[model samples]
Target: MEQRESGGMKILFTGGSSFTGYWFCRQLLEKGHEVIGLLTQKRENYEGIRKERVERLSCEMELIEESPFGSEKMIDLLKKGTFDVLCHHGAYLKDYKSEQFDWLYALETNTKNIKQVIHLAKEQGLGAIILTGSIFEQNEGIGNVPLRAFSPYGLSKGLTFEVFRYYAQLYNIPLGKFVIPNPFGMLEEKRFTFYLISQWKRGNIPAVQTPHYVRDNIPCDLLAGCYGRFVEKVFVQKGPFYRSNPSCFVESQGAFALRLSREVSKRSALSCPVELKEQKSYAEPLVRVNAEPAIFEVQEWSEERFWDDYVAYALEHY
Candidate 1:
């Protein structure tokens, strides 16, 4: 296996067409690492947008169109490729509430894919594998919580983590896990923050059923920087790295909407009236874990600054 040196470690990144994957790859490239992005040929929604971004940003790195879950092909690539790490960011992301074929899709795209990657990593004798996790894996309630994923999407993520953990323990493979909070920045569309902003841009009042739900928002660039630092730390250390916190504070939906409204008004040529009307009750409090200190820490971005930057990016893009 190729070792980490000044030239940078060779890494195979799955889900290169994902929002998180796109930013993560950019960060790795900026840090002088050699990244080989594995992407599928088909394009849809966020994945399609992410794929375009990766193509636009990554000119030097090798972007291959191949299914990472194809065990035979992946094993062959692992054997031939001089890679130090395998970053698993690919998953079948769907709206857990409305999407059909929930469990079956999750099983194939998430659980099965992870198991194959683990076996291939071991066979290749790679240095380490880093996994991008989600806060949704936690149970919804007030205070510190346990791993109890309620929705199908959350359940998929939870199951994937367990699979990775199990293989890491049983085979003694080096692994790093980082659970990400709500990330906003470039190429982001249809998410809550951006969705609200878009509605306000059209001079319309947005309505929500759950205005009290809390979320920890992190900018995509900031999240990428943290992930880069974590990857470097994992390469240098001998033991596995496991961190649940991305060091973000929880903010309520009502607070977020108000702040966003303020930002929209400030940016508009004339006064942009904004109001969030409450409807039928379906609100649920989201529980986020306290951030534990890590080997590499990033300066947190303030909500105001984040909103300003987000609005600027949105205006330029949209």
Candidate 2:
């Protein structure tokens, strides 16, 4: 049954301070739903957004003021107000494996803390629980690949999805898992865009990596629209909606094909399948550019002027 978007949906969002969460909240607001955001603190940035929207910084929504981590105080907060939806979109993604502290931090934010929030929401009988997942979840480990590094961030996401799946079944709660691929666009803060542009400016990113191996780079606003579709599909579409090329065939062993498209394209050519040529690994990237209506079409990133185009996009948006 298609779940109609009811009026006045009360949503409790955790990790309102991050990039993904920021975009998610903007989408929610655009849908005309009432949202209470929980962030780490009332910093200058938060205050600015809050001033724009009175509800953005309400004490009821701002649980981070009392407790730094939402996992720690989720139960008590739920008891105060019955939320229609709970979104666990907070995560730590630093690009270093040797950093033991980063690993532990990722664990706390992704795994343990999420468990706490899920438990509390389940006990409270929330309408739906959505957890943000990543493409790295499909890989074996984090940041281990030579050209592509999954990082501790990816590992944490993998475990988080597993836990969410297990607990969703255990509690018999309606759940939506967004297996998001690489998302890029100008939204909320352009820190990530700035970082990419900076790398391009400094020639820090290699030419081989300039065009990105994956064509799944989506604009932030467009991504938000996709999230809205997923939310609509939570009850409409059967099971969890894989936020990827649903038509792309995968091996029975869950290894996706990488040779869907050709080696070169006037448009963007993803390294998705090219890089995996040497590894002979079970998991291979597939490009389904067969002209059929794919579940998801990779947005073509201009290869020749990728950096220039990317920088232009960021600057224009900023």
Candidate 3:
């Protein structure tokens, strides 16, 4: 296993049972870092854990895989232990469209769980908190973009970012929000990947609106590398606002985060420079190839205001 010679660090990931979560854990473990995983078993259909696979990938690192988001017992178990890092990667995205969107289940789950973890981190004064942010949470210009269709998911991510921001401000803790575009590759769920493979497996791939329009279509390997960097550099840093994609760290002593694209036409005390590499692709049009938008907005506003803008923009354009 390869890691910083300094020694091993204990890390906790809220969602680590499957897909990207599984690989994230694997990478951390490979780096000789200890990982305490929290798996929510709400999805009974896929209830069993692949212990064999986990044991194989875990290698030299310690892994305590269990559900720590549900009841008092679970929370107590989490609180009792200590972790150098606490990452909230656990999210419920069972289906693209569902009636449960009205309930705002993801927001409710993420907010409550993240609050608990943050409180615990504050109490322990752990490293930093890393929350996953999707590109969908961002605005897509003036129309009904495909990303805009992710209303419920976007709302949850927006709320989660706010919650982390508020807590970071109140407690004066180090924090980072990894706002990723579309990250795909290894440990990729066959079901989902198969769906895409099937689509492209056949014939002409229609290019939706050209891929260059998107922001950062990062690969999982690159994403894992980014995560490792965050865990090392930005985790213990002071202040807030660190974007993994464009690479900006807004420390407490620095300026706030504003909207910016690959090209910086406008400047503000709030904006920071971050280089983003673009990719090339011919339209196989399975799922908007290499689409990474240039503009990325960091910082926060009220949910009401966000919803208003989102709805108005979506209605007019979508």
Candidate 4:
């Protein structure tokens, strides 16, 4: 393993095809660090976007199509490679659709595989392991709250955090967990925000099922930049990076949607009527996580600027 000039870290980044993972890779590259991506076989169109971004930036990055769950292969890579940190952003997010046995199996497999990765990292003497968590782990909008994961996907994330924290403490590894809220930006697939924008563009009133149910939405790019800075702080500054309580960075989802709709209307020259529909019988709880001051210090984008950038990007891409 060759050392980089001026102490630049070599990061082993997982989830290369994911939107957040791609943004994180781009930000790390922008900061003059070496990144090697470990991707799965299920490649999406967004992988092309990530590749294009890497090419456009002229940054040298390696994409290896391998499973992180391959314990022997992963251990070999960590032991032999020049990786200083393992930035794990990979996860299976799809729910098991009421298949209890399948969900339990997936949960067990994910937890076991992640534990193996952590053990490998510790054995290889990596500097730090950054786990990208979700706000669903928290019960309320407060810090240090108990886990209240209702869905299978949320349960998986919450359990993963517990496993990561356990290993970090047991092995005395510097582990950082970033509890992400709803991140909206230039996404390859049309999700809630994109669907709303499409409806608005077609001069249709987008129905808001949960108008009162609030969420802390952060722009994907801003979150990625903050994560990059967090990495730099952890490795370069040699600072303590362990956070038992997940840090939440976000804005009101209803307000975010309104701003997005207005921007879409302006961009498309169409009247985007926002219809606040009656709440459904089965409504998801308001996911409001409290933001830590330490986390906010690294993030630069404000709500207004985020909307502006988001609208422009969507108009160009979507």
Which candidate leads the pack in TM-score?
1
**If ranked by lDDT, best first, what sequence of candidates would result?**
1, 4, 3, 2
Worst 10 residues of 3 by lDDT: 249-258
Candidate no. 3 TM-score = 0.62
Residue 229, candidate 4: C-alpha displacement in angstroms? 1.5
Runs of candidate 1 with Cα error greater than 4 angstroms are 1-3, 42-48, 99-101, 113-117, 138-147, 270-272, 289-296, 300-308
Cα-based lDDT at residue 183, candidate 3: 48
The collision pairs in model 4 are 141-288
**lDDT of candidate model 2 versus the reference:** 0.50
Q: How many pairs of residues collide in each model?
A: 0, 9, 7, 1
Q: Using lDDT as the measure, name the better of candidate 1 and candidate 3.
A: 1
lDDT of 1 by residue, 218-273 (tens): 66877787888888777668486555466444576677667666776787652544
For residue 88, model 3's alpha carbon misses the true position, in angstroms, by 0.7
lDDT of model 2 at residue 43?
52
Query: What tens-digit string does per-residue lDDT give for candidate 3 at 214-293?
Result: 23333354456556656656555645666554322211111111121111112211122322223354222222222222
Candidate 3's displacement at residue 67, Å, is: 1.8
TM-score of 1: 0.85
Candidate 1 deviation (Cα RMSD): 3.4
For model 3, the stretches where C-alpha displacement exceeds 4 angstroms are 1-6, 42-74, 98-100, 113-116, 139-149, 190-193, 199-216, 246-318
Models sorted by TM-score, best on top: 1, 4, 3, 2
